[model samples]
Target: MSMAPAVDAGLALLILGLGLWIIAARSNFAAVVGFMTYGLMLALVWVRLTAVDVAMTEAALGAGLTGVLLLGAAARLPAEAPGGGPGAGLRVLVAVLCVGVAAALAGVVLSLPEPAPSLAPLVAENLPPTGVKNPVTGVLLAHRAIDTLLETVVLIPALIGVWALAADRAWGARPGALTPRPSSSSLTLLAQVLPPFGILVGVHLVWAGADEPGGKFQGAAVLAAMWVLVVMAGLADLPKVTNRLMRYTLVLGPLVFVAIGLAGIWTAGAFLALPAGYAKPLIVLIEVVLTLSVALMLGLLLAGPPKERA
Candidate 1:
């Protein structure tokens, strides 16, 4: 706390530099890499602000998962040729517009009222009913359960959109990765070595989230990354898009959540509300199912559409 100001200044400068470089980078890959770095750095900023839950989400999903997804896209997509981009006049106009927007945002942030109208106090006051010790988890699962439910639900449609891009003949086939199976011994070794630890850490994160800074989303991202790495190394294969078990597994979380939510109307008198005295168990059950479904969905999304038939 004593040296907070200096730390904040340094972090802010570093983030600003990363943001500028990401915008200025000529290559798409470079910009994506810089974006991932910026996300991780911003996670540190979140931590310094005493928001560990948000920091975990930022580090795991924003940086870790998104970085991998974009890198894979960069590998598969063709790059635009140099000088095929906007001309100087257009660039200057866009830069001016961007700067004006950034200045407006900064002004708004600076002008925000003191004693921020946050829901922290409300969440704290009602957290005990959720039967979870972590206030973030409580808010996500109990206080604002519908919002969280909708977040997971949206992933389903997004994945559907990705799969819809596949050729007709590829409808039932395994999805293609951003890159072909990498056979490098070093990559193979890393793929073989890292997953066990990654899996353990991922599970631990979900488990500890009940009372700590970690959570299902963060843990799910780690699990998804490990699966993607192994699949890319050719140690594992993605199931066909039409695989019955895989398809069912993808929807298991939301399906279960909906069932429980509807049951809540009878037992708890409100949709998405947990029955009294069983909140913790039900929440844990939902999280466990969600973790698995989310991990699979994310891995498959990163893997792209099904491979075209030969």
Candidate 2:
């Protein structure tokens, strides 16, 4: 076997081992670290498979952002108490069962057929008409546009579920009691610098997305990060649930997308079909609105509740 395959195999094994270690280990902190390592290693595996887009996503969303979220969650959790109840025999049996299942899965994956002729050619042929260079994006926005629209709809309900779970808590609760007050000197500096830089990057990502790997989702995430930073730093307060503007912004993306999709059906006999000669501009408009909606949703998720203005 070539060295490349050998390296890939090593990395895959390392990721699996770390995942198993995380499951078997008693320490929550150690488990979180292991999960982070698994995410990074998984990104490497994606790179090895020549999926740069997936690799970037795994690196950003899985490793970097998820690790930060997990660490923050870990910090809020209570320390492990003495005297856990799982006996040795139970642990052993569970481990054995898990190993058996994993082995079965690996065998199944190994037995899968190799790639045959794919739909890439068909997609590539249609790319020019769609005005998207990337087949993945074209498939997402054009061929499977309904799926994309529905997924955005699902996001709102998911956010609602999270909000319902935390409804009783203060909307502006800091992570812990030791959460530093927002007016601290260093925090003020962060507040001032981070939001603009984040917005700049977010806009760039959205624009570059036309020809690059970035898109509405990634750009929205960056914009959301900026909103989160500002909210956490006390530079901007969360709006009340009754706030009309906040509610509108939160629902704007899906509403706009749906309206446009219906309009497409009227104009072109197909849902989400951009009018002839205006496809690129329409797609960009839809994406911009989607980015704004995603940013608002993310900001609301982080902010929890409306804070009372002092």
Report the CA-based lDDT of candidate 2 relative to the real structure. 0.74
Q: How would you encode candidate 1's per-residue C-alpha lDDT over 1-310 as one tens digit per residue?
A: 8798998999999999999899889788999999999999999999999899899899988997788878877776679955687898998999999999999999988888997568888888998888899998998888889998999989999999999989888788889754545488888998999999999998998998888888889999899989988887888878889899998999999999999999999999999989999999999999999999999888888888998635
- What overall lDDT goes with each candidate model? 0.89, 0.74
At residue 258, give the lDDT of candidate 1: 93
- Stretches > 4 Å off in candidate 1: 81-83, 87-97, 178-180
lDDT tens string, model 2, 1-310?
5798789778978987998798877767788888888888998898888776677667766776567667767766776644666789998998899889989998988877787446888888887876877666677777788988887788789677655554344454422212326477787788788888889988987777766777777777788777666666767655666567877888999999898899998887888887776777777787889889987776565544333333
Clashing pairs in 1: none
Q: Give per-model CA RMSD.
A: 2.1, 3.8
Model 1 collision count: 0
